[model samples]
Target: MDENGKIDTRTAKGQATRDRLLAEALRLFAIKGFEAVGTRELAAAAGTNIASIAFHFGGKEGLYGEVVRHVAATLASLYQNAFAAAQAESRAKGEEPIRRAHRVIAKLIAALAASNRSRWMSLLLQREFITPTACFDTLYEEAIRPCLEEFSQLVEATAGLAAESLDNRVLAYSLFTMASAFSRNGNFLRFTGKTGYAPQDIDAIGRAVAGFIDKGLRPSA
Candidate 1:
């Protein structure tokens, strides 16, 4: 163990290098947009040699894939944990399953808001959607599809709707829309004289979102 009483210096250094690359990559991607940035530029921005990307990630495309995968993995873990916690909470309170599902969605929004990296991921995802690339399929499979399936299941089980129910799909899409609006349109909202929500506003947004979805999913009068 090193002086820090943890892993040795070599392992720590390796992790630091990887984190430096990710941080630089994220900054460049957010500022210049992904398609516009090149490998050498990214290396220079990260204060490393061009060969580092090749060594660390196999090349530019591989690095991009890694960046996307990193974010996707984080989000998947967040959602899974949030859902599990919501389920536990529901069981503890003896609440209806549907209410538990709503609670899960709220937890998800709160999780997203709590992580700046997640917010960056959301922005990067929106950019990817707007400009389809080879990485689109990778992101969709790794991140989007799983989340969609989970949300669908939560809605179906909670609302007692069929797997193929149009209403379930609509509800899932609406939730996605709501989440994306904050993520994708946040800057636009600020520009257009609307509220400039910070990371702390995530819970409030989540509450509002849960309320909206609950009202929509209610049985028709």
Candidate 2:
């Protein structure tokens, strides 16, 4: 790895091998977890030699860390455009933070739902959150904390509260958890008699989530 923490393989073939290792590691880790997976299994799964892991990632632990980074980058890429648009819209003149926040929350929920194709990614995250390892800090810093901070700031702005208030943070987490619950489970689709998260279904769910958050965030007279 280099100063930026990226694999520093110089060859295209080496980079391809490294990429394959990370992909296979994520799949296996999401299923068997870190403890159960071994170097041999990872190498065989990636169709590379065991030494390749050491060369590219240092070892299993290093590979796992890279896997977390891979997941973090992948998920961030998925929502970057939508989140960027919301951020820009919120900065517009006469824009209402509360309403924009609601829309952001809705888009987030829908994005998560659309991302269900990578169930393994969420399962891996669930495991990390439940039983963290040495790489938990990397995962938190790279993925979870940024999201929480973004939501917290949005919540503070939406509610016209002092920055970093406990209430704002808690509400932001609650909203994220609510959306995450729907994304992590298949029960939502089963209950709704839907086989897949089609575009129309995602849109309706997003609208509903936006309405719910909007209602909940408003102050009573």
Candidate 3:
């Protein structure tokens, strides 16, 4: 606290510095994992010195918590916004819940798969899954759990699955994994010798996913 009552790091400049550190930390952590990343590298990447992390976040671990929050907020904006937007559009049109759910699925595919940062955040999420960290539970509750609840409800509405059941949970997870494959396998595009698709292409992919989902949701062949 520099002998004062507090460090007074709440100034605009300090906040900006803290933000930079969090951003660089997420980028590095996403690639290297938490244990492999060093505070010095984080400082360098953020164009700040090491002490700034201590002043703002208390240390690397604290900084990582902040980064986790940032990642959660980012996903909320990009992924949840897509789902919400599609559902709103579908409802406003007087579409059935099944159709609205289809829109949700297609929008999630495009948002998570095509958006640039989502690809990185997916990598970060994998790191979290591979080994639980201090931020694991918080991140799940703040970001993932809510996402699952929203998804499960959509699935139940679309497929007539019992709510809050194991079946609905499993169904939601499977669908999430399939759509996430877009980002997880994005690098495979180079194999196809084709350019990357845009986020807007969700509409086209929606048609395909909706048709596929409808087939499964149907009563009989």
- List clash counts for every candidate, in order: 0, 0, 0
Model 2: per-residue lDDT, tens digit, 90-193? 77746777777766777777776665345667668778989998878877777777777777777776665555788877888887676566666568889989
Predictions in order: lDDT: 0.75, 0.77, 0.76
For candidate 3, what's the RMSD? Answer: 3.9
Query: Between prediction 1 and prediction 3, which has the larger lDDT?
Result: 3
lDDT of 3 by residue, 37-85 (tens): 9989999999999999899999988988888888887876666787789
Tens-digit lDDT track of model 1 for 1-221: 66777877677766677778887787667556777999889988888888888888888878887887786777667767887898899999999877876797788776665656766777777778788677788777877777777778877876666757898888776776576666654675677676765654666778888888877665555
- The local lDDT score (0 to 100) that residue 106 gets in candidate 2 is 73
Q: Which ten residues in a row have the lowest lDDT in candidate 3?
A: 212-221
TM-score of each: 0.82, 0.80, 0.82
Residue 51 alpha-carbon offset, candidate 2, angstroms: 3.7
